[model samples]
Target: MLISMTSEPELQNGVGVQDSFQRLWTPHRMAYIKGENKPSGPEPTDGCPFCAIPAMTDEDGLILRRAEHAYAVLNLYPYNGGHLMAVPYRHVADYTELTAAETLDVAALTKQAMVALRTASGAHGFNIGLNQGSVAGAGIAAHLHQHVVPRWGGDTNFMPVIGHTRVLPQLLADTRKMLADAWPVD
Candidate 1:
């Protein structure tokens, strides 16, 4: 949330005037968000990170069953230990672009992912959502995906309110391996 403090013209270089209370995201995130560190410019091409997950299993921390149209990937910065994202293969922006069958498939996979994560991580519940537009907090607006974040009792405390930090126990790769091992076969 930012307010225009002065009559000064908008900053053109995208180094937007920082708000007084804003804290920094990670350095790498800043570069990626600012388009300085990203491999592709503006649009996705041959080397999309999500697309590379299935083919290059050694990287990207993919953690779930791979279907014809969609796959689940471990969140690099997880809200919880087994927080995962179910994303469509094609880079469609929103729900309108997805067929009814595709939407159903995403839902089915999301349910399976929740079960797998719960079994592997001992998570009691989940918070599932999809931020369709940037206003809703979708980081990659070009590719629509739904997040399945695991939750447990006592997981929430005063950290977000006081420390301004999130504590995650397992690394992305470990979570991926655990969840992938628990994925349903057939």
Candidate 2:
């Protein structure tokens, strides 16, 4: 619900006063903020979404690509448009636990994700890496996943800064299709 202030009196009440600003209410974010789907334990069977995602169809999983050891999927709560994650199929908490093959596969998928984002949306730059653990900002600390966030000029502005919200122009399904089509053939 957007409250636009037409006059100065609206700011005084601080309630549902009409405001001039166009609000983009995102009630969905509450889940992520509240850690709704986070794993209950350190195992794949403990409700780990990353571990469970592979069993689902690509569309249902928002998966862009799949390799023997890892896969690329869209972030359920994206920091930017076309944001992706390269996740190892194994449920490992830290990057050090990944086998050589899993490490190589995740790195390859991460690179491919950047290429796909560039090809799909002309991404000017990217922010890629993984949080080592819960203390380091890993939302799903029970599993290892590397972030691949695409960036464009002026992509960051008052929306995320002042408003603390992001305006995504495309749906996740559509974005998934675009990235999947744009994925490099390996």
RMSD of each: 8.7, 3.4
lDDT of 1: 0.70
Model 2: ten consecutive residues of lowest lDDT = 1-10
**Model 2, stretches more than 4 Å misplaced?**
1-15, 19-21
**Tens digit of per-residue lDDT, candidate 1, span 69-125:** 887787765667788888887768788899877787788889889778777878888
| Candidate 1 local lDDT, residue 148 | 94
lDDT of 1 at 178: 84
Off by over 4 Å in 1: 1-42, 46-48
Superposition error at 16 for model 2 (Å)? 2.5
User: Model 2, residue 24: displacement in angstroms?
Assistant: 1.7
TM-score winner among the candidates? 2
**Candidate 2, residues 1-186: lDDT per residue as tens digits?**
232323433344475665577666677788888988899888888999998899999999999999999999999999998999999999888888999999999999999998899998999999999999889999899999999999999999998999898888888999999999999999
